[model samples]
Target: MAKKWDLFEGYLKCDPNIKAAEVVTDYVENYRSQAISEEVQPIIDRLEKAKADYFNSLFDLYEKEAEYMRIDRKVKDIAGVNYYIKPVVDFSDINLINEPEIVGAQVLTTRLFPTAVKREKYSYEEGAKA
Candidate 1:
């Protein structure tokens, strides 16, 4: 089955530095500030409702999943389960507003390098030859 596209994916692609919560806030604020025509207002309203429903469901799922994990961990710990063992319930790929930013300074640090060199080692003639 094809994967469902996430709403934050587009925003993150545009600006990787933005947090998921910021994307939702910006989207809602932008939608509210827009002046829609009478003919298209109903469609816009329906779209807004749909987006709200989608986000609400996602948030609900996130909360439940988190609670389940916490309970599962506690139960396992009480039962003397091995620390290296994985959780029984694997609920991966759930996107939440509280998730960390998509991009970080580490990403840039990997691609960039220092260009400076000591003046004593720097030679104008050698540099020109290269």
Candidate 2:
């Protein structure tokens, strides 16, 4: 019989940073547990610092994942059919005409982020008035 591995193994195998992220997460959880269980003030403070370090590491990992996703989107758009990505939410009533632009406004408005189609939904009273 052959050994069977789950799909998650493929994801974990793709990036070394993911392993580091997992290690940091374990440390964070351990420090959190220690902070909760122990009553010593100094030890709790030290654990908090350790937890912060783990959080910072996880943030860096997340940034790398974001960069990877950006590049992956580009590649997929170039090679595959143009389509909307997942995790989209529809906000049809919000107006952004007077809103000030922030950094990466173009990317956010595009397929990478959730789109807000500025339009009103159909209502009985509004329809009757129209």
lDDT of 2 by residue, 43-130 (tens): 4565598679866965775676676776666766776665554311212333432333323554445534325544333333343221
- Candidate 1 lDDT tens digits, 1-130: 1122344567658766767787678557653344243224645665598679978987787677686887777777887845554554454544333322224333344543223322233223354222
User: For model 2, what is the C-alpha lDDT against the true structure?
Assistant: 0.49
TM-score for candidate 2 = 0.27
Where does candidate 1 have its weakest 10-residue lDDT segment?
114-123
Off by over 4 Å in 2: 1-39, 79-130
The TM-score values for the models, in the order shown, are 0.31, 0.27
The CA lDDT of each predicted structure is 0.54, 0.49
